[model samples]
Target: MEEDIQISFLNKLSCFFLIVLFLGCDTPGKILIKNETQDDVIYRYYKKETDENVAIDTVSIHVPALSEKYIILGFGSLWTESQLKSYIQNLQKIELIKATDTIVLKDKVEIYNYFKKRIKGVHKDEIEIIIK
Candidate 1:
């Protein structure tokens, strides 16, 4: 009876470890922004927390027409994974400005879904912004 109980406990422990490993592998570690447009674009992103807009930073990349550029969103080290996820979900707004025209992308289901999908899997999540 003692040996049986020991084996059962070992089996459960192994299973738990396997589950943790699988989940950790699937969690996304980075955010990728791809610019798919015909002109150079400037992207500005802000974090929306409790109805306040906190400016993160601005990125300027010369993504040529029909090309893609990758931008990594790096949060500070003080933030936990849950905090990062919440901040990503609450991304207030993104502005894509080219020349004199400005385009705005809001935080909605589509955007959330996009980020959620990117947050999973073995690769960084990518958001493709297209200007038409």
Candidate 2:
């Protein structure tokens, strides 16, 4: 009985380690590199606030080498429409930039990216979107 119990415990330990290793291989985010000939830099910014649980907003920017040109901007989940609209408008007004491209907004539970000239401030609770 003692030997059987020890074998069972060892099996569970090995399975747990394998599960962790598998998960560590994949991360949560939307960023990919293309055109290896060019030296481009990718950046990710995260801002968070919490009431009870933590809420986070992430921004990803890809700057091309030897130029002021950027290719991509990503917005992770937790960013609402009101927040995005306000952020875009503020960037246009303050930074003197406009949206030269469009981002596809889809209803999926995966990490999402929305390109922008800049990201602005957060939205107030009064402008919340009701899902009901």
Candidate 3:
């Protein structure tokens, strides 16, 4: 009877651990940048923290004329999901610098809504920037 009780307790503990593992498997929010352009583009990603715009990463990739690339940006533990989404939506400047030309994308209401929707799910958010 005591052996049976010990086995039952171990089973319960295993179940609990499995549940925790499944719950923790939820993917964090991310940013995906797809470059569909003729020339090689240099992209910079930034986040606003403590009232300052901090550059997170910079990548220069030669995306073919029709192909796409994904850039994943994860959220920090310091802020909630909503706060992180808001910060990304409110970003005033996102630049695609190519050669001597620089294109600036401003965050309008529609743009913010688009980003909010993209980053809403557990999947990574995606944005396609086309350079002419």
Candidate 4:
């Protein structure tokens, strides 16, 4: 009878530990998306990678009722137009470059997830990639 009781206690302890373990961890394949809704809100991140005070060209793309995309290209910062064009074209040809989503929370915890993209980053001449 004592042995059976001890076994039961051990099983209960094991189950409790397991419950605690699973509860304290984040499940894989789960990502958070945050939507920004406001006028004149700077939701995009642009890095010049240089200390030049040059004018940068930004392109914001929004499908009327569908999706949104933002691209910031700095003029005379580092990359030439041809280099940027080639890089953009190569990015478009990639197969797994899916949607880019951002998560914004209270207290300013923000992160960006590039979904379905096998390559996290690539190096190009005269330009540095920024992931936020």
Whole-model Cα lDDT of every candidate shown, in order? 0.57, 0.38, 0.55, 0.34
Task: Single out the weakest 10-residue window by summed lDDT for candidate 4.
Answer: 104-113
By TM-score, highest first, what's the ranking? 3, 1, 2, 4
lDDT of 2 by residue, 21-48 (tens): 7765442322222323235444444444
TM-score, cand. 4: 0.23
Tens-place lDDT per residue, model 1, 1-132, is 999999999999999999997765554334444555556666666555554464455444555566565554443312244544565676766676777587676856555554454443224343444454
Candidate 4 lDDT, 69-120, residue by residue in tens: 3333443222334543333432212111114544332221111113223122
Give the Cα error of residue 17 in candidate 2, in Å: 0.7
User: How many residue pairs clash (N, CA or C atoms closer than 3 angstroms) in each of the candidate models, in the order given?
Assistant: 0, 1, 0, 0
Residue ranges of candidate 4 with Cα displaced over 4 Å: 27-132
Q: In model 2, where is the ten-residue run with the lowest total lDDT?
A: 123-132
Which candidate leads the pack in TM-score?
Answer: 3
Candidate 3 residue-wise lDDT, 8-127, digit = tens: 999999999999977666544445455556666765544444545664443355555546666554533222456555656545556667766876656656445655444433333333
Best by lDDT: 1
RMSD of 4: 16.8
